[model samples]
Target: MTSSTHPFEQEEVMAYLDGELSANRAANVAAHLRECAECAALAEQMRDVSVRLSDWSVEPAPANLTKNLEAARAEHVVAKVRKPRGFTGRLGGKFPFLRNRWVWAAASVAALLILVLRIGLPTARQESRQSEGLQLAYTEQSRSADTPESKAVGTASDNFKVRPAPPALPASRGSSPKFSSSSADGQSNPEPTAPMIARTASVSLTVKEFAPLEASVKAIAQRHNGYIASLTSNSPQDAARTLSATLRIPSAQLESAISELKQLGRVEQESQTGEEVTKEFTDRAARMKNARATEERLLDVLRNHTGQVKDILATEQEIARVRGDIEQMEADQRSLQTRVDFATVELSVQEEYKASLQGAPTATATRLHNAAVEGYRSAIESLIGLGVWALQALPTILLWAIALFAPGRWIWKRVRRTSVSQS
Candidate 1:
């Protein structure tokens, strides 16, 4: 019906009948349907059509059609499954290199060998060149020295094998510091630099006099131009007093300090160890060089940036990060240097104790109380242990019982039958 003649349009009425309209609109349509017979009749006809659609059903497909669909599906699946693969595809599914375990092992070994050679060859060549240079320098120095004093020094140099120092690595800001190889007379005096070694020593002693032991330990450290890192002293009421201290001493004076410490008491145990850290120091120095280079590049970028604020900020952030890394690495280098410069000594001293019959013994009541407490603790522990065992073994026990139940019953029944038959 036209909207001019009716309050609701035909589409609105149909939507109301289909329950698609909002609640208020649907209520108004219902009220209008109750008052207007013609609109109500039209709504009734729409509802009747919807009811017919809801009840209607399509006929099932013919049996041959179902069979034909099934056959088509099977043919498509077969075609997909039987698709031909290229040589590369087949090889990809089963790689030739993976077929034999020995091939993988051989390849791994070859790669490892190549890596070792690559890393070792350059180092070996550098060392050889350094040694040759050192030898030639020694020869020149020996020829230059003709005086008796110089001759004696030259003969001494001949007996020693001079090792050349490694090439100077790049520093953070300035050039690496150089050591003068010439004497005050401007004559070359080649002295071999020793490899860096961090020394550690442990000494145990039994002292007769405990009064001066602590002072002696401290004196030993001070004498060697070192400091006590940690010290712990325990003096029991009736037992021998003990003192333990960890000391850091100049490696040059380590032997002397250890000998002096041994004289303070009868030596019970003594041991010394050294760890070479030249390579470790070299590696860290190289890394610091690279980090400093990165920081310098970032600083340059930050200074020359004519780009957006964000780009400048990002560059500044990167510079800050690199600077932080450089500082941390510098601190690490200092710590490593300290280790090489100092030797660690672990000292333990015990005072000699003589037993005397003057001290009072433990009371009987106190001993009885301790015994009772220990007994209670033992009983509780035993109970806890039993509970734990049961918890751990219950499942296994139940499983075995279930598994053996049937066979056990069969065996019992056969035994009873045999006994009855014999009776």
Candidate 2:
């Protein structure tokens, strides 16, 4: 048996020593080792090292150590008897390092509450602002409508306005302006109450007939003077296309379109929302109008002022600046107009097909192979997870378990032994 032929690797030999190799594999290794002198000698050396390492010992504990241990045992017994159950555990947590289970539990609850507040507060604020805006809209609508009820409401508003109006406020406030969407108050009186914001509706579903549905959706979009901004369908599990598209439909037609889309498939999930951009639209329109006015005045100065070449150049520059402003405002106006004309519908489409009940889940051998592979992977993963946790937590777990459970177990054993002796 030469090292060149029958010799095994260190890893293989170690695995065999650990009893990890299967019977057939281990038998092959053993047969090979019988013919391999170097490997047999190496195995013998490993055994010697193991035995030599096992020969070390520790000194015997002193008699005083025993006495001290007895005293410690007595204290532990007293603690077990008098330990204040849940309250003690809870109170212990207050001492920073000293606090144990109850403290951590309370802290966890407190942290959870803080997290909820952190997450939920902004949402609550948003809801509150929405509600307040709605209320404000209703108020402004009544003011603009100028009904008898409005007159009564106006009286209350008049009293409110009597609080020595700031110079920034317009003398005669017509209706609440949408620009007042800011956190600031008394900035501007809003234009006649904005058109009520329409509700937003969206749906995500899988449809086997998605290709056909896409055509229908496209047709609907065009009929309503809307356009599809995006559409995509790319998936293997689907024989029919998967469509995720943002369709721009008139706000008025949004609900109707969504209903039609739902008719095409079983809706996996659907949502409806309302956002009042009326205020934003109104405010932007007002600002753009003011900017245009300023721009026009600059242009007028540019045309009429035929002064020095420098002044003419400066005037032209001013006109160009004003024109730029007008262009920007025009863009803003167009965008707002588009929003009023076109509401966005975000749709997610999937194709679901009914299959033969008896013929479902074919390919048994492949499935079994996959199952075996997954099982092995899962076992390895579980073993690694256990090893990691044990390595990380064993000391702490052992210490606490010994500190807490050991005393009780010792007392129980002592009592049982005494009773047996008495018997």
Candidate 3:
């Protein structure tokens, strides 16, 4: 059919009306639309449809929509340029939903939530267990308040308060008591208690006399069967003397030691901290026990087993590994025990210092004589220093002077000769 008579000629005219056709095609369609009444009517109808769609009011697109569209277009171009290969490409092409931004975003959020649940749940459970253990320890301490001194110390500090421990559980059958919420029933288990806490304290004091305070601190440590881990005294001539000491006291004696130490001076600042190492200690003990068991099993195997040389060597290596693990675990247990047994006290003592104005002034004549002698000495020293510096630089100066002198003299002679010639 002739171009003007073809059915698609009307579509071309509509495309021209919407400015969708290339310039050349649009020109042809425009020419056809002007001559043919049918094509012109079709173009007019399409224009009306466009106007009607524009009139249907809708919310404006979000500001980021343009950026997203541009990004999508770029990604599309890249995908087309380098068509993906393999199973991934085939799967993605078959399921176009996988290419959606929202789908990927949702998947990422789901993955993050799963990861958080996996990691956070166990950590939260462990913390809850530790807290239960601390509660149990505090509860045990509260039932028997035999120490009047500790009570007094607690009463003296406003920040200190006795937290009554939670209700005790029924005695279970074992050397180490196991407390749980559940009792032969399918229910939630009571939280487990940890072992003990390593406590520490820091006290800063302003004392009238540093020496007496120092002596008192040592006495207090000795009385408690504790020893001074370290002691430092800083005394400046015109300033107050300060004493810093780290004291290690038996955990049982910590309260009494702190109270007695405070009595030696005016307490300026004091802070106490208790770190519950019960869980850590318990874990180390369990590990050590397991290691010992493993070592014993290996020892039995080594003693009883009669096998090939290769088998014996392999068994020996296993025994060695088990022994090493046992040693390491034992060391950890000892370190933990040491911390639980001894509490650290960091004490800082500063003397309430006063400046003294008791010294007599020097005689004017004597002062003048001293000043003159000092000035003379300084001048002599300065001269000596200058002579030494000049001597040190003498060779370099001479070398530079010699290097420049010949050239300078020759240039002068040449200038003189030129001047003479000119005259």
Candidate closest to the true structure, highest lDDT: 1
Q: Tell me each candidate's RMSD, in Å, in order.
A: 23.5, 33.2, 19.4
lDDT of 3 at 338: 59
Candidate 2, residues 291-334, lDDT tens digits: the string is: 55555555665565455676567556766776777677556655
Candidate 1 weakest lDDT stretch, 10 residues? 170-179
Residue 37 in candidate 2 has what lDDT? 74
For model 3, residues 382-408, the per-residue Cα lDDT tens digits are 999999999999999999999999999
lDDT tens readout by residue for model 1, 86-168: 53233223343433558659857975785456444543433444464432122333333354533341122232223322213
Residue 361 displacement in candidate 3 (angstroms) = 3.3
- Model 1 scores what on Cα lDDT? 0.66
Clashing pairs counted in every model: 0, 9, 5
TM-score of 1: 0.43
Clashing pairs in 1: none
Off by over 4 Å in 2: 1-193, 196-200, 208-211, 237-241, 353-423
Per-model TM-score, in order, reads: 0.43, 0.38, 0.48
